[model samples]
Target: MALLDELAAREAAMRWLDERTQLGTQTVTQPDVANFPFNGQTVALLLRQQGICKPRQLDAALSIRTTWTPPGGKPPYEDVEGPDGLVRYAYRGTDPDFPDNRALRRAFEHQLPLVWFVAVAQGVYLAQYPVYVVGDEPENLRVALALGNQQRWLGVPGPDEVDRRRTVERLTKLRLHQPVFRAQVLGAYERSCAMCRLKHVELLDAAHIIPDGKERGTPIVPNGLSLCSIHHRAFDANVLGVRPDYKIAVRRDILEEIDGPMLKHGLQAMDGVSLTLPKQRAQHPDRERVKERYEEFLAVG
Candidate 1:
């Protein structure tokens, strides 16, 4: 193998080792454009495992451009053919000697400074591949790779920034809908609970306005209510609802029962209370859905 190819192989090996070690498993095959999707963090993990801990090494790796194409037909761009007649792709700069080659290289030489960009972008693209069957667009792949890389690097928040990056990456894959829902609800509720005025993030739950299993579609902002756990469970179980006018309501019987004082003191006090309007009014729950849910709650008891 050439020097750059040797480096790339070593980097790939190191990454596999790192993953194996971290996972407490034996050595496995390296991640690549084929078996395991390649990204910046994967490259970085490999480099770090191999003791190439300098940013310069990362920069060099990021500068490489690997070949990617559809299963059949010519690539959208030109590629340089090797002795074996297969097009060779490098992660580094385009082969300066073959200026006329149709091979399109994903630009990374100037964009490497945005650390983890490769991994994040590639990871997202890879994740969507099964669903969307993303095609090989060099530029889009570059962006996806970079984004996936950066996201992976920022996995989790901790003493080690790398760990934090990794955590974020994993979370991104697992709960893709969470951030969108949280942003929408928080924006709608002005970052406070509509019921308890709970502004602290740790104390809040993005309670689904309509339960997930109840024909409510996804847990989007329009289908969500910002509530503390107490209120969230109550809302889910039909103990609470929001009127079409955005006023809170409690089940009448729950409020009137002889043993209702607890519900009254704890939840009934919220009845008729105006919603804590969101800063971005556009994010507020749809009145129609809320009204429908309210009607449903009324029928339950």
Candidate 2:
């Protein structure tokens, strides 16, 4: 009878998941799960025992909690993935109500991906992953309650095996490269877009002077340029080119074409302008790398 009852309960939980998942749209954490995924290890343990340990948190996005508090709750620390691909989420052990420690452990043990939400002035930002939990404990150097792991979001089914493999590979590469690259490049550029000086970090992207897969292409800052999203796209698509001398050049065909406000001002108008550079000479884009990429651009043009 107890086994039957447990089976019935499991069926109920599965039913809840089915009812909550939107059939047409992407899967997100249902309100109940997202609102308070885990309050502490006890809550997390209870959820896991009840067969509710895993619910997709939208895209499994990861986020760093900021100093800004939400209306009622304090924020969690930003999780950091190290150069070796190990992720560490630190927490102060003082708060018993802080459920992240247990939650992280459960996710690791079960091999489930978890979503991290960070509170900010505007709203919450999130990071998610199928991280392989390496266990949680205290560290001496930067000692705190830490949950460490490597991100490996590969288990979920995709359109097919090839697509799944490709997606996972790309995600792994970005996990290893993007954050460090962005941080170094943005710091050098003082967090502004190099092309148009757009100041928002969210609007900025670190673009490679030499494309990432090329012979000399690397993730170092000297080979990076912080550009706004639009300009990054333009730079990548060959609509905009940066010369060895750091001048901006629009493709001749794009400059010659008549277009609307976006093209007229955003792209063509910026032609022949010198790039806004980092104040620190050491952080400046390497001219040799720029020359190599420019040669490619000229060849395409």
Candidate 3:
């Protein structure tokens, strides 16, 4: 019995993901996971029957997936992203010694990277790669994963390491978490723009009501809006905003400006329109955050 080279597998996974991203694919499908090329041959990155994927030739777990819970529903197991930015994944069925769990533990011990397929919708997933199983917490029946180069900063650090850790945190949010955030927010709105109800997933994005740099501006469903790329850019630039009551508001100057069809129809036409929110009230954008953002829009206008 032989295992595939861990480094080669990780490189292949990254290459596969890069190709997908370049093609504007925001979500990974079952077929995408099933027929990936590895080691000059086709290998399944995930299996249909298991969330923890370790192919016969793989010594370490290839990937672990988590599903999106329906609105107001509980997940089979709780996987949490902590304040320190590490994501904790529960072991299989409360058994830290389970084969899948042991493989994950081995991944940590061997410093091998694994893919974490985070569900953006019921069947749609966002693939995050090069995440190392950094901690094997047998006591808690879970393992901790660090994205990209984040594991480098897990231990006690010097002042420079502290700054580097902050950089990694920011990059993790940008390169890894941002896509997951997009998937979750867009999925929450059923892949439609909240303002215009545009349904093109390729053009959609999760806009922050309060920018992520702010203390209270965490990237969660309550703080995000499903917007098309144009609307997203407009919102970010204060050209558009949503009032606390969920009314679309284009900046006064932009509304009155005679620019182009995109401005008149895309932005101005949306002014005074009621925003289309997620059906589940709990998933709606935070009113206070919207108000604060709208105020900034007002100040700019």
Candidate 4:
């Protein structure tokens, strides 16, 4: 089992590296020789040294390595020689002031893929912020300054675009549905309606205790509840609510004025019954958020 797990990990790494290298090739035009030093041959050689043969295995390993790197600190940069004994490219620290020696040391310590991803992500991040080039302008410095100027005009840092891309990548890995609020709520509820235990994904909705439109961007799961259409509408309109302790409640006004066996069976009968919980214990709604909603429900006119 241990050997199998190790093999699986290696395979995953190979896949990740292949995809990332492809993405880098597609996205980075005339990438700084200092930043992307490894050519195809160099990458192949490195993978061989690490005992990785398959592209898929290389990618998976690189993905894990990239994701695990520390969030902050100067990125690693260095120069690598091609098979022809020519300097193919140089890896430069993302921060111009970052000492190349220290950065390279850290890169070697953690491995190149980790450093590469950090630099790529950081470069995308820094592209968003204002860039000011200082000191007597050498030719290369002047080029960087010109790029910064163009970045400002083009909104090159494009934080929103970068964030969206990162979000998609991360969420994809987690297998999360788009429109995260609903996905998160449904995920917690295992795609079943809390009120009816209806497993029909299409019939269920991720109802917010405080309607999202009203909640002003607070989309925490504790502020959410899973309900079928009828129950969700009822709860949203204040005809039904749940206490912090999980006890169901129906407004006296709704119970008195409504007359139907369906209501009695579906809504009123649910009174005093507890909500179905998530399969995983950790996915349960936060107690504090639930309590706050419960209190607000009580205070509503």
Number of the top TM-score candidate: 3
lDDT rank, highest first? 3, 2, 1, 4
Per-residue lDDT value at 286 in model 2: 89
Instruction: Give the Å error, residue 73, model 3.
Output: 4.2
Model with the higher TM-score, candidate 1 or 4: 1
For model 2, what is the C-alpha lDDT against the true structure?
0.55
Writing each residue's lDDT as its tens digit, candidate 1 over 1-301 gives 3345434544454454346333211111124322223344333322212211223223233222222232244644343422221122322223432321111121222222211101111121111100110112334221123223334343224445555545554444343345435544654565577887977755667777766557764656667788877888888888887888988888887777665555666687887888776554545777778887888888997
Could you tell me the lDDT of residue 155 within candidate 2?
43
Q: What TM-score would each prediction reach against the true structure?
A: 0.47, 0.51, 0.80, 0.43
Number of clashing pairs per prediction, in order: 41, 9, 0, 25
Give the winner by lDDT.
Answer: 3
Candidate 3: where is the Cα deviation over 4 Å? 1-6, 17-25, 35-42, 71-73, 82-84, 150-164, 197-202, 260-262, 279-282
- Taking all chains together, the TM-score of candidate 2 against the true structure is 0.51
Give all candidates' CA lDDT scores: 0.46, 0.55, 0.79, 0.43
Q: Write the per-residue lDDT of candidate 2 for residues 188-245, one digit (tens) a residue.
A: 7878999898898778888999999898888777899999999999999988999888
By TM-score rank, best first, the candidates go 3, 2, 1, 4
Q: Candidate 1 regions off by >4 Å?
A: 1-57, 60-174, 213-216, 258-262
> Once superposed on the true structure, which residue ranges of model 4 sit more than 4 Å away at CA?
1-178, 213-217
Off by over 4 Å in 2: 1-170
State in Å the error of residue 35, model 2.
Answer: 23
